[model samples]
Target: MRCTPPPERRDTAFALILTALFGACILLSIIIPSQICLARGGEAEEMNLSSDTALSKLTEGNESPAQEGIPVHVYITNNDNEKLDVSLFIDSELIDHKSISSGSDQKMDRYLLEKGRHTFKITWWDEDVKSSFEVEETRDITAETSVHLYTILNDKPEEYEITVNLVNENSRELEAFLYADGSFKKSKKVGKESSAELGKIKLKEGIHNLSVRWQDDDTKIEYEKTKKLMVKRD
Candidate 1:
């Protein structure tokens, strides 16, 4: 007959086996989940980075200029009661012509214009009435500028005045010279965000010439403008 093992020894062996198995299970439970979470978190971070990159690209595209050109805004309004067929010209170049209904307004096609003075002309085409009225206007517009034009009847037909309004929209100051009838009238220095008026120049019943020469201290660019004013003496 074989000798039997001690009861305490057997009990100790069973407890050790159970403890080893429990430790293995606990380690698997903790380590497996941690690995899964790390994988998921890595994927989420990659996706977020891609999304942020796409958004940054979109913002940059929108901020950049559509084309390598300057921006100018031109607005035209029809204040007359009658419908008008309007023809618009810039520097004697025909840009657009359209029929505008009464009391309606329209915007012109945006195009980059050269800096300096430009002649703007508007002609009305009336089928019923043959009118010989044409409006000619001039302005010195820089890059990224907005200009407005309108018509106003003078109170006196014989004597009228033209107002020269100078505004320095640049960052630096500007030295300007005013000329009336081909003669230098005055000189002024206009600061940024400030405006200087050359005052109302009285004119007799004739065509008068007005011009301005200015130098921008920031850009060091010299700009000049010449416009004609026609006055009818009653």
Candidate 2:
């Protein structure tokens, strides 16, 4: 039989080879950046760059039409050294907002609006970032008017008494309908400070939505109020 190296020497030689290979790997790692290098560490997390949840609307009005509507421009910046994806807002209303890579800026514009103040909002989301912003501005509207109305109600067992107060602050007379259970109960004129009292009504109580409608006024001016009343016997 041919002589062969002892088991211990063979084991030692194999171990030395493994050590050399490990050292070479370490040197290469120190010299090269991996394609899958981590962009950022997990020290903190961010949210969506376009995820926002607040909204606001403001109106502006001018006695004379010659005035200008509001003009507004909003700007967003990635203030963090880390690239940020975020949204911006004016007064809780959302404009176009976006993700900003690190050290970048963005801008958006909207009508300042007339007769009321408007809310602007911005939003964003990402795997590790979430943010938002807002602003408010006022502009003048030349020819439109607004009126707000409400209802007062008290409920008794198997019956309800409701008082509808209709007021028109506009220079023109306004009319609207009072409804219950999808049926028109009454139509009344609501002129400047003119209001009518609707008599008591009996209703089976659960969940009900009360809606008020009028024409010749801003279609955006519909007033919807919800009331939850329970009917119980004494």
User: Which candidate has the highest lDDT of all?
Assistant: 1
lDDT of 1 by residue, 1-234 (tens): 222122220001000000234234334333432121224533632112233443354346445455655666666676665667777788898888777766676776676877778888776754434443467878886668765444222222345665677765656666768777888877777776667775666666777777777765556667776767676644
> All candidates' TM-scores?
0.35, 0.26
* CA lDDT, every model vs. true structure: 0.58, 0.42
User: Clashes in model 1: which pairs?
Assistant: none
Quote the positional error of residue 76 for candidate 1 in Å: 1.4
Off by over 4 Å in 1: 1-68, 151-234
Root-mean-square deviation of candidate 2? 35.5
Q: Go through the candidates in order and give the clash count of each.
A: 0, 47
lDDT of 2 by residue, 1-234 (tens): 122122220001000000234234334333442122232554433332111211111112313367566555455555444544565544564545466665566554444555454444444433332333332333334444222111112122354555455545545565666566566666666555444553455555455545445654545455433334444432
How much is the lDDT of residue 128 in candidate 2?
Answer: 34
